[model samples]
Target: MKTMLFSILAALLLFVPNAAAHTYISETTPQDGSTVTENVQQVVLTFEGKIEEGSTFKVIAADGTAYTPQSITLVDGVLTGTFEPALPNETYTVKWDTISQDGHPLSGEFGFTVNAPVEEQVIEKEEESTEQEAAPSVESTQQANDEDAEKSTSPLLLVGGLLVIIIIVSIVALAKRKKA
Candidate 1:
């Protein structure tokens, strides 16, 4: 019984950490619900875990324009989808089915809006104003964080489950040995 418990605990420790590192979007480049005046060049997704190459990231505008960047990069654990000039003021829905470091394909999206055209604002405030505006509101961003937590913690549950399975198998073996 003691040996079986030890084995179960060992399995939990071994498998739980990787499950905690499952793929999730750490942050979005534009962030949630930010009104922008200029056209965005790309949508960058910084993932918590390493993503497999050749996975797809996309932006679908409220205007029904599905813009996909021809190029993708997974450098230093960030997945970037470089786009051309963005669509007009509208909500953008980003989606992806990327392979996680643990070899699972994860997919989700958060929203952002380009409120103003960037060109006119830049032309008007062309004072080279580098003023960093106040941070965007964050109520919506919480959903993305929730997704991250969900991905990272799923492995813990898996570990717990595997531990139970091992414990059961071990108990059965011990019972059989005692009977014999």
Candidate 2:
């Protein structure tokens, strides 16, 4: 019986670290796989737990132009990175690396497209010009919105999966204890 209890405790100890090490993003500005209609001046990441001092993140434009944050601040579980001159209209990928409160290193990357709002151009029509300005199609907008919804739920799914694993482990341990 003692051996069985020890085995269960050891198994739980192994899983505990894995659970504690995950410091996932709880919220973000310019969310993953989203389309921003205005200039993005800053990126904010809210984590599930407090982060260390050395935690940092960067933004990379689709054309390989990397923009380092002008200032980064960490307050408890929230990390905010600000950029100067605003990010130009381009698809950007945010990559971040941080040390969680548990001292475990965590890193992740997510991409978003920026479509800054443009001022309407005033053109003097000469002899009834028929030129028309192009606009985004409805289908494309719908697709982008759908993608954003899918990405937003990803963190929730991760938490649900972890809960399921823990529940299964608990059930198994209880069964073993009963048998012993």
Candidate 3:
């Protein structure tokens, strides 16, 4: 029985290719760990799989500052999101979550560094008017954030819950068999 269980688990893991593998950043605009001489107007991230059309993508800096860009654009299977303005010298983190053509919501993160200072980065997000914004609602953004957190939680809890139930059932069944 143990061998059979192991086999099933191995098979499941094999067939279910890491959902992470299905979507990956193949090439980034700044590239990983690259030091940029000039300021970058956008933090473009290109993925291995095609992002679902009209999906929301986001980039967050390592210092916990998020790039609320002007807009996110998809071209020829590549996702390029334009930053509100160029950022200053510091380590910036890029995070993205989007539904793939395969229908799975994929999300991941990476970081890059810029040599500039903070003041330059601060002005970009301010260029846009808070009142006449064309971006998605804050409510929708919050909902997506909640869903992303849940995705990170569901699989672990599911496996643990299943294992607990299986052990309990096996113990009860064995006790009954011995009594008989």
Candidate 4:
């Protein structure tokens, strides 16, 4: 009887490590903090281990609207979720929660930005082509350039001023710490 008990204990110990394996995010589409030019129709995430059922995926717009799909499917460690109506231009946060095969709960969030769409880019290119054909006189061209320069100066100054202020604050903080 003691021998049977020892054998059972050894078998259980061998299986414990395999059941406790951790699942992690292996890859993600649109990558964290990246800007995508194309309209996003779906979001894909690959995991290192099998994802269990009852997983949740969400895409939240900058305006705080959450986009949840009807269902999330996990196949061969890859999770695919399709968004209805597609995603528009904005900064979006993708949040996911799932249980790994080991029964561990995993959750994480990532952000990405969507820029102008393909159609808008094509239209802008056509407009630029027409503008170049109807080139303005030298005087008007110079005036437009001057206006653009004036419009761009204020923002540049603001950014530069902010950088200078940050540097000054950093130096003062470090000097006080040194004196102490």
Against the correct fold, how does model 2 do in TM-score? Answer: 0.59
Per-residue lDDT of candidate 3, residues 1-180 (tens digit): 564465456445544533442444566767766666446667666665677786565666777877767877887567777654456567777777777777777776666677644554344345445443322211100101333446655775676567656666666766787799
Which regions of candidate 3 deviate over 4 angstroms? 1-22, 61-65, 116-168, 171-175
Candidate 2, residue 84: Cα displacement in angstroms equals: 0.8
Per-residue C-alpha lDDT of model 2 across residues 42-132, encoded as one tens digit per residue: 8887887788999999999999999999999999888888775567789999998888888868777777887865441112122114543
User: Each candidate: what lDDT?
Assistant: 0.68, 0.69, 0.60, 0.66
Error of 3 at 24 (Å): 3.4
Instruction: Please name the candidate that would achieve the greatest TM-score relative to the true structure.
Output: 1
TM-score to native of every candidate shown: 0.60, 0.59, 0.54, 0.55
Model 4 CA lDDT for position 48: 72
| Residue 11, model 4: Cα distance from true site in angstroms | 25
lDDT of 4: 0.66
State which candidate has the highest lDDT.
2
lDDT of 2 at 87: 77
Whole-model lDDT, candidate 3? 0.60
Task: Give the runs in model 4 whose Cα sits over 4 Å from its true position.
Answer: 1-20, 118-180
lDDT of 4 by residue, 22-134 (tens): 57676677676778776566777777779888877899999999888655778988887776445778999989887888787877777788785668655645764777432
Clashing pairs in 1: 36-115, 37-116, 37-117, 37-118, 38-118
Worst 10-residue stretch by lDDT in candidate 1? 134-143
Better of 1 and 3 by lDDT: 1
